[model samples]
Target: MKNTLKISLKAGEKIYVNGAVIRVDRKISLEFLNDVQFLLQQHVLQPEDARTPLRQLYFIVQVMLMGQAGEGMEKTRQLFRDTLANLLSTFRNERIRAELKHIDTLVGQGKVYEALKAIRALYPIEEQIFNKDSLQEEQVFAKAVGE
Candidate 1:
C-alpha cells in the first residue's frame, strides 16, 4: 500500500493483474505505486499440470485469483482445503506438512501469489516422494512374482 513495486516483462510475456491478463508487445517495465495482486508468467500453471495433488491445489487457487472471487469461489476454496487435507495425510514429512499449512494460511489471507510460491518450493520434494512410491510399488510386484 505504501511501498511501490516494479515489474519487467519481455515480449510475448503475460502477467495477470487483479484478474486482468496483460501481454507486453515488447520489453516493458511497470511500476506499481500502490498495492496490487498480480502473477508473473513463469509462475502460472497450466491446467494439464494439475495432475498431482498439490498441483491441483495450485490450479484451484489460480482460478480463485483470476475469477475475482466470483460465484463458486467458496466451492473452489473448499476444494483447496480438501486437497490440502488429502496431501497432509499422504505426506508425513514435517517439512512438506509445514509447507502445506503455510500455503493454506496464505490462501486464507487471499495471498494467492505467496501460496503459489510456497507450493512451487515443494515441487521437488513432491517429485521425490512420487518416485519413492513408484519404486516401492515395483518392489511389491517383484516380491509377489517371486512368491
Candidate 2:
C-alpha cells in the first residue's frame, strides 16, 4: 500500500480535492489514505493573478485539477496541450524549455501537484526574461526616437 499524505488546514482555509472545494471551520488535519489530487488554499491562483503566459498555463492546469464534476475536463486538457505547445515554441531559454518538457511529463503521469511546483519554480526565470525583454523594448524605442 502507498503511504498516506497528511494535510493541516487552519480555520477558514480552503482546499480543493478531486474537484471539490472544502473549507475548514476550524483547524484540522486530514489524512489521505489513498492517492488523490489536491491544492491548498495558498497555492490556488486566482484568475486575475494569471497575468503571464506561464501563469496562464498554470491556471488552465489548475482548473483541470480543481474543476468540479469533471465538467469541461476534456476541453481543459486540450487547452493545456495547446498552451504547452505554444510555450515550448515561445521560450528560447534551454533551461525553461527543458523544465517545461519535464512538466509535460509530470502532467501526463497525473502528477498535477508536482507539475504545478515545477511551473512555480520557473516563475523567477520567466520574470527575468520579462524584465530583459522590457529593457530591450525600451532601448529600441529610445533609438527610434533619437533617429
On lDDT, the leading prediction is: 2
Candidate 2 runs further than 4 Å off = 68-71
Model 1 vs. true fold: TM: 0.90
RMSD to truth, every model: 1.6, 1.5
Compared with the true structure, the alpha-carbon lDDT of candidate 1 equals 0.87
Error of 2 at 86 (Å): 0.7
Q: Give lDDT tens digits, candidate 2, residues 5-101.
A: 9999999999999888999999999999999999999999999999999999899889878863454788889899999999999999999999999
* Model 1 C-alpha lDDT per residue in residues 30-82, reported as the tens digit of each score: 99997778888888889987888878888888887776565588888888888
lDDT, candidate 2, residue 124? 99
Off by over 4 Å in 1: none
Cα distance off (Å), candidate 1, residue 98: 1.2
TM-score for each model: 0.90, 0.93
